[model samples]
Target: MYSHLLIPIDGSPLSMGAMQTAMAFARDAGAEVTVLTVVEPFHIFTVSPEQLQAKRGEYERQARAHAADLLAAAEREAKLLGVRCEVVQVESDDPYLVIVETASKRGCDLIAMASHGRRGIAALLLGSVTLKVLTHSKVPVLVYR
Candidate 1:
């Protein structure tokens, strides 16, 4: 019943699987897809202020390029499936916030994402963005593990 789907990609194999799943779902539902890739802002606390400022631009550029490439692949796959796709790249320290905001702002009816299935200490330390999105997003979330 979803007319618009939002899919977040991290360029991992699991994320790719989610992309494929979302594509098929979108095709079947006759829905448009919005592919989002969030890039983490660069942080180097050890560096001096000047050094950090100098390197920030380059770091951000590289990150944006990587995100764009990831979104491009998703777009291509969705196009092949005859699904309309839009790509978004955002730079944020809190990806979950960006994901939720983008979903709401874009008027997506559903968010389809992949969970890394991290558990125990790893999950505690790194934290799961998908989990955060599910917790915070107002829109419906469809997580593919």
Candidate 2:
């Protein structure tokens, strides 16, 4: 039933696993794929405006480049299955919110993402972005671990 699928990738091996799963699903369902990458915003409280500007720009550039590469790779895989695909990069400090919002705005029916598999102290301190997404998202989410 999912026609427009949103796949959020962070260029990690875990996320790559999710991408593969999403690609397979899309191929079977004849759905279009929307690959999204989010770049966290600058921390204004920690850094000055000027400093944040340069650092944010650098990070954004790197994030965009990485997203482009990921999208390209995913696109190649989708092409082999003869499926349609599109790529988008979003800038936001709240990755979960951005992913949810983008999926809603794009009319995606489902979100397919990879879990980093964080646990214990790391998960507590860093928190789970995928968890936040699952909690906040109104649409269906298929998490790939």
lDDT of 2 by residue, 1-145 (tens): 8899999887788888798889899989989989887755556464334335566677657657766888888888788878798888777767789889989999999999987632335457768889988989999999998
lDDT string for model 1 (58-87, tens) is 877877887888988997898799999999
Residue-pair clashes, model 2:
0
Model 1 residue 86 CA deviation (Å) reads 0.5
Best-fitting candidate, scored by lDDT: 1
Worst 10-residue lDDT window for candidate 1 reads 45-54
Model 2 weakest lDDT span, ten residues long: 44-53
Q: Compared to the true structure, candidate 1 yields what TM-score?
A: 0.86
Off by over 4 Å in 2: 42-57, 117-123
Report the CA-based lDDT of candidate 2 relative to the real structure. Answer: 0.81
Each model's C-alpha lDDT? 0.85, 0.81
Per-residue lDDT for 51 in model 1?
33
Give candidate 1's whole-model lDDT: 0.85
